[model samples]
Target: MGEAKELSQEEIEKIKEEIERLKKEIQYHDWRYYVLADPVISDAEYDKLVLRLRELEEKYPFLRTPDSPTQRVGGKIEGGFPTFPHSIPMLSLDNAFSEEELVEFEKRLKRFLGDENLEIEYSVEPKVDGVSIELIYEGGVLKRALTRGDGYVGEDVTPNVRTIKSIPLRLLGDDIPFLLEIRGEIFMRREDFEILNRELLKAGQKPFANPRNAAAGSLKQIDPSETAKRKLDAVFYASGLIKGVEIKNQKELLQKIFSWGFKVVPDWKIVKGIQEVIEHARYIYGRRKDYPFESDGVVVKVNDFRLREILGEKAKSPRWAIAYKFPAEEVTTRVLWVEFQVGRTGTVTPVAILEPVRISGVLVSRATLHNFDEIRRKDIRIGDWVWVKRSGDVIPEIVKSIPERREGFEIEIEEPRNCPSCGSELYKPQDEVALRCPNMSCPAQIIERIKHFVSRNAFDIEGLGEAIITQLVTKGIVKDISDIFFLRKIDLLKFWGIGDKLASKIIDNISKSKEIPLDKFIFALGIRHVGESVAKILAKRFRTLDEFLTANPKEIETIYGLGPAVAQSVEKFLRDEKNIASIKRMLQAGVKVLDYHEESEQRKKGALSGKTFVFTGTLKSMTREEAKKLVIENGGKVLDTITSHVNFLVVGDLGDRGTTSKLEKAKKLGIKLITEEEFLSMIKGS
Candidate 1:
């Protein structure tokens, strides 16, 4: 060991002051970057200062610690927020992204409250940027804190919450209330957040976007001390589990909370009229920077908690309160051009390329315009200045256009008179917004049709996507849909990435797809107005694809959702000379596209005999197309989503959101969930 050199007291104190200043400075930069989405210094410059602190800490082993800037982002949260179902569902707040929207929300509330002569006010609290928690107090002692999982059940996080300083160790009042659950956010202080992110950047890791995400990632920690080191603070702003409580209104509740030694958000108001409410909301919006913790937006609730019960809630959100979410980001961008893109099924959709601009936090260079009709309706034009916005920091959209600044030379574009891809005639039927090319021989249409035919909803071929399809098309390897069946292993690797195994799987899949049941064959053909439901009906109504093809416009027009226009389109499509030739070539190509009903009828007349089944959730057991196949093969029918017509509803691990509704409706209408075990046991060979 080396002899220690004694320093003057002033020098020692100065060194200590420098260490504190550096930490504080790093913390402020973190807030500026993560919380505000605005950084003052270059990333390279930020790293140098952080490196100095870390080096000093290393030399002064006593100063070396996990709580310091080094170990924040080392771990990840465990699988899924475990369910600890709250007595009340943690309903999401309705967003108001702008001040105008906030005013409108206030207007409607005041108007409604006026009817009852009970003017309502709200407690404008800090909408903390962290994971929500339900802190349970047993006899004025901190007993438990659970995460808000799915509005009911949440993961047990008692150990993590114990580390936060703001969370009270003991209850304030000795009035001896029974078990009480106070809900609030758990977040890292601004300073701690900066150090964490700075260390992350130095390690060549992607820094977190905000303190909210950091706080959330930290508190859900599997290790308690790690969460404690995050310097997480809590504000018990709301109530969840409560016993022996007498609460009249929100204001009194907040005041009682503050008096009982709790940290209440400052400057809460009970503004009644719409104007005052709007003004108050604006005040908060402007003062968001002044607050210590991160707040994405403000929450406004009807002050009279009684009126809250009266207002009730919608199926999705509450009626009494709404959150006013300020615009995440917005910018003016020039529209470079709008082009039509045709999907595999010949749906002509519009895509817009914008002059590069930043919207929200991401770069905005392109956006989907949806359809030609939507473009015309929005009056979007090239060379026009348009306002684009992003919600929740992603997905750019052209919100509005500035027509006043438009030049007189603005050209009015008409939907293409012909198919851009095939150079054939395009047709738009009556009452339909989309214009489609009826040409089956069109190369673009052929690839799209063939791709959809092999999609998860249709033939269930997995290996063939754009890369392979492009290679096949470009190499003159596959021209029409039927050409795919003839592809050899060597032909697949003619491009890059494909091997003998992949080529064989694709070919095997192609061969398997040929033996498709009648319903799949019908849908794979991409007929007009024939969605899965309509196709199922058509499949049952007409036993074969050829028979349906043979039916005239007058006979086909009678089908549900298929009118005279669709009937004409279908009839016209079948009669096309080129399409007829393609059908002949497909038949000769040895595609087993003809209905299997003929073979089934030859054996047992009622292929779909006595069983009815419904499918729910995403299936890992089989593709939805394959499940439908199982139903058809065993003399059964498949229904869309869930309906009364379905006899057995097949359920999977799609989580408990919309599944319960389907189950409830099924119970009301008398449908049941079929287990794979029970199904296999009951069906035997089926």
Candidate 2:
């Protein structure tokens, strides 16, 4: 070990100057190689500068400081992960799923800047599909590495992050900030991920699901050695909690960080104007397959720090930056089988069970065929290779079958003649495409009904998932949705995975679910054609289940918006003895379905009351589910399509010049076309 010897003034000054000069040279080379993707010097030349700095620091120990380039090596390993509060929150970016959405993002930025014709410069970079982490460097020395746990608070994994070669151990120059927290993504390259997975498989371990998952798992490992073995890399994207840094824009920040011996994200371009932003995003999106690592989208940020500050952020994401995601990745996989799923409404949907394939970072084993008609239309068959798409990055859908790839032995998918659950005759209604199971007491129907009851849009039971619902039904713990509330702790504990804590939580959720609003409860009943909107309408009209159950079809038909199909479905559900018995059981279980009729009155007079909204295209601020919920919660009605009754059309970014029937109808009906932002404003005002 080098001694902490007292050095002569001349010797100390010479060593310090040499160290600073070497640090600057090395940093400049790093910037050239890593950031600009251009290097003037060879690898040996760069190493020599670092070696010289090390030699000088060794000869004159007093000349060394934390800010020296040599100090970039990781600090002492800790026994346990400690919590670290982020000096600045690592907020997520708002997403733009389509070109129109990206355009809308630019429009919003200009609007926020109070200039319709403002020439806004943007920095566009790949939105890496990886784990987000923050690196804190004090006096240029690596201080801590933190996982973005909740944005505000993070788990310290300094020991593990030290293993990443791309992240610098210390700042490059003495001119660097006293304290700098860099936000970056820790990712595994595609080739590296594949190699690691293969090694894991050879070692008789389960292969990683995807590169992102692999990166996350590697970073969280308790053993630093394990993380090192995984060969994780990082790219610094933005600055957080920086002291003594006067960076003015994203471009400057990128260059500055790169000059500090830190790796900057690749393919990032500084573009002028909104059109360039969109063009760059689209170009990057199209070249996704060519990249070395996984990237789902392109992130576009305002180049100016002032613009970013002015634009500010939302509760969850930054308003200044938008992630323009590519259309969900489509890959070909074989259909192993086609199964019929009996819904709570007894509508049998055709689900294509596929050979497990990875699609857009997800393990997709099943895709929806919608119905038997769709299967026929697409000519999907067992043993046929089909193009399975992760639609919108959420749903797995069979886009089309590769009929050319189909073998002669491929079997055509046959429509089920009888219900798969109860073996009852399946019937298809004249107006509908789905085959229905008439037996209300069918096991599949019961299971599905229970699932529907606990779904997000219905009772919203926190702990009662579909798998748990199936287990409860199969184990005879629950026979109907009402049985969920009446389950004993002992009964739930009998299930394999239902531990004491989980069982207690399930009980609590069931107890909480009893106080659900009238509309949600009505929708939870598994009644055909009685979706959330119809349920809301019925709840508003009748006020209570007792009132609704007593009303005849003709009486229900008198209500505005209550069509013949919906009225018939409601009347039929109420008249059924089995359904009535189930309702009675639910009542006996102490279910207190809250009345929303009075609230409906208050809502009608409220801000958005009397307003009917129709949503078109893709919304950026929220999901379609969230949007519908917002409308309903704000005392407004949501319609599927634009019509004369639709007071406002909440239009989203419908990419390109595609014609929308809803837009046409809205214009024809003189309905106001409002943007998603405008709709959000209306909701907030209400």
Estimate the overall C-alpha local distance difference test score of candidate 1: 0.65
Query: Top TM-score: which candidate number?
Result: 2
Candidate 2 segments whose C-alpha is farther than 4 A from its true place: 1-116, 130-269, 278-293, 308-319, 405-407, 541-556, 597-609, 613-622, 633-635, 639-686
Model 1 residue 607 distance off true place after TM-score fit, in angstroms: 40
What digit string (tens of lDDT, one per residue) describes model 2 on residues 237-322?
A: 89898898788999999998877877777789999987898788778877777876788888889899987888887645787888
In model 1, which runs have C-alpha deviations exceeding 4 angstroms? 1-80, 94-116, 125-131, 141-149, 152-163, 169-176, 186-201, 207-236, 259-263, 292-297, 325-329, 333-386, 391-394, 400-686
Q: Report clashes for each candidate as comma-separated counts.
A: 12, 3
In candidate 1, what are the lDDT values of residues 1-686, reduced to their tens digit?
A: 02113655676567666666666566556545543347899998889879877776665554443433433333433432344667777766656656675665665565655664445576665566667888777776666678876566787777666666455555554554587777777766677778988988998876765677788888766666677677776665677656776777888777666544456665578776556766776787788777667665677777787878877764335767877766566688888877777665567766678888744223568876656666776788887888886655334677777898898766555677777777777777664567877766667766777777677677777679977886787677877766776777778867777766667777777777666677676677665545454466566667776787687778766754345545665677678766566666656756666563443552233344556666665443234555665565556655554444567877743421344445666778777677543453333332
Model 2: colliding residue pairs: 72-169, 72-170, 140-171
Tell me the alpha-carbon RMSD of every candidate. 15.4, 8.4
lDDT for position 23 in model 1: 61
